[model samples]
Target: MKLKSFLLICFSMFFVVSTVQAATTISISVNGTTVKTDVAPFIENGTTYVPLRSVEQIEGLSIKSWNNKTKTLIISDPSKSMTFRVNNQSQSDSPLIKNNRVMVPIRFIARNFSSDVAWNAYTKTVHVAKINDKEKANLKSEDITESRIAAINIPIISTLKELTAGESSAGYFQLMFPEGESKNFFTIQNGIINHYQVKENAAWLTWSGIIGGNKNTNTFWVTNTDISSEVGQRPTSKDRLFFYNISEHSGQSQHGYISTNGEKTILGSKDMNSLNDLYPIPEEELKH
Candidate 1:
């Protein structure tokens, strides 16, 4: 019995030590500059994961927004945008928090941001660098178009109809419209829009409209306000014009209902006390 007990104790100690050794700390460098993080990076399942905060240290990359309730993080570079959810089981490799710091897969970030990544096994280091001009030229035509689209600021509940019309390459866009008692959510991708209505707890196809504007102008036009439908069809009414004017001095975008006859009822105006500007809903909340 004494000999058996001694063997069991040794086996437990070995297993514990092996587990600790498997998650070895690794070094990370971005654009030839070494980045230091409060929570050290580690390798697991042949993939290197780094702290989320460490990624912000890279040039041209910053955290655009964070939703504490949903634990979602949005990161944007100059030409690209990426979204990640913390502890999202739906994703195979979701961002996780370790030592109170969020950790994400390094290779995933590099691929999304159009950066190059190399792993040095001998030194246990990961190097990330921006793609050179030659590499950028080799990228697919769709990629180039996406970079251009990313530069445009499309307001919520709007689509880039004028910019993306007739182009086969489409980017992901979110739209939210109000229904009878619930809100309808849609994601436009590759010229196809998928609808999800909150009140009915159902998803279906619906007709959508073009809500686009010129960047230099303060006013934009909205046609065919009715988006709720059971079948996919083009809207027949092109006369229903909803105009929005953004003031340059005040730097405020205001929405109002403008009839075809030229009568306008702006939000918060004395004529329309009940109308209010629609605020953007966080992506995390919309997804849920």
Candidate 2:
């Protein structure tokens, strides 16, 4: 009995350490304005987790209880009239509650609801722009665009920004860059890239079954190089496909020439047979 109890305790401890990372205070901004919430936001597995419900904010979001504590969270947007399971049992990414507070996946919510989300790596803040927030987000970016980094341009597409820019701006996207021929490109063996909202927090999943291949996630945060000391391992800035200026608008991208690290494989919309087809970001959306 004692041996069984010890094994159970070990499993519990492993679960906690694997799923949870260092808690950092996050700055929440919606439509370019700071928002105060009843409960602050936190990060897990490199994704930004927000309270399932905000106080007098996000009027469009509404939810029902967790089915008598089965640990399943359901949310709906009557404004958008969409619903989905929080745990997404079939998927690796799942919403969780800590400290008696339930947290929803902000990135997942933004993607389905037509929203844009950006992060300020230096200040460690988050920017969320809903359908209405887009105009405000654009204006906010304009205000700081001169002082902050401008939207990066993709060398191959010339018309589009780096794929990473969309994720940086949208805050949640699963991007993939397959191995193509490029002397400068990084992360050679092309496969789908599972991006952790934050680059440094990805290593925690090395032992987990969920990770597809973060090695293709060649994007790195050059400005906050030391930010991962809390996570013990430093994120590699080498072999990243793109690097942008580390400004509030740029989400603390590395300040320098925009990286053409992995554009060797031309990205297209209609032709999935081309190089690798990751999720497509609207062309106009790249400007902001």
Candidate 3:
């Protein structure tokens, strides 16, 4: 990578804060359950520090490997492994042990596990979630199959538009999990989506095809601070789209949207137009 581009990436990966929130009511919630610990998480420099050991408490998540000599922690299952080495206490993203508690970047697990992470200021909560179809079996959503749109008094679109990988301004990714059984495509961009409309905004979008391995599904997921909608409800900022499956560790993020742009876009689940809605991930997002 070019020096300039690498510098930009490194800068974006970090954060800075003037006031440290040590006494804040920060806590960790996995799947949907709050992770209990005598040692509560705290915020420093705009990054949340969580008990590294609190990770193991999460049922489905386990330490696949821990090399004490190297101070390396590998939180993994059959699907994913996250590596984080203890850096010097002065380093920004370094892991630290406090009062017999192991602390690391709070967002480390969520980012690596394909789970969505959010930090809410109003309620002072940290949300981490690895959502899936099995958990949402009760709140299931159906496709826009011809019948639904017919009642809306609108003409249906005959065909969806084609998507080309590497063509997106924001990079694209192939999120693979569910033990090699699912491959979801996400083309991320700093814009929101509206059904049958072409308006771009500042919020970022994580567009995908067939969320949770659902066949022929179009999901226009948002990753920002606005709480656009309520859970399992119509468009709002509070929604999130989890793409992987889980059985043992069902820890999800605290309920809130984290953003730098102060914008909220409604997450997609139900179809917008019978034919015209947000496009799906391009076929090229898949690995060869």
Query: Which has the greatest TM-score?
Result: 3
Error of 2 at 31 (Å): 1.0
After superposing all C-alphas onto the true structure, candidate 3 shows an RMSD in angstroms of 18.7
Residue lDDT tens for model 3, 126-174 = 6565544333331122332122111111111101221222222232121
Task: List runs of model 3 lying over 4 Å from the truth.
Answer: 1-23, 57-59, 90-93, 133-288
Stretches off by above 4 angstroms in model 2 are: 1-24, 64-66, 79-93, 133-288
The deviation in Å at residue 17 for candidate 3 is 23
lDDT of 1 by residue, 109-207 (tens): 876776656665534557675634432332222342232121111111111121222223222222223211123333333233333322111122233
For each candidate, what is the lDDT? 0.43, 0.35, 0.37
**Arrange candidates by lDDT, highest first: which order?**
1, 3, 2
* Residue 99, model 1, lDDT: 67
* TM-score leaderboard ranking: 3, 1, 2
lDDT of 2 by residue, 49-155 (tens): 77766512443556644654577755656554443445533232466657777677776665566555555453455656443333334324433232111111110
Alpha-carbon runs more than 4 Å astray in model 1: 1-24, 88-92, 131-288
Looking at candidate 3, the ten consecutive residues that score lowest on lDDT are: 196-205
True lDDT of residue 282, candidate 2: 26
Clashes of each: 0, 4, 22
Error of 2 at 25 (Å): 1.4
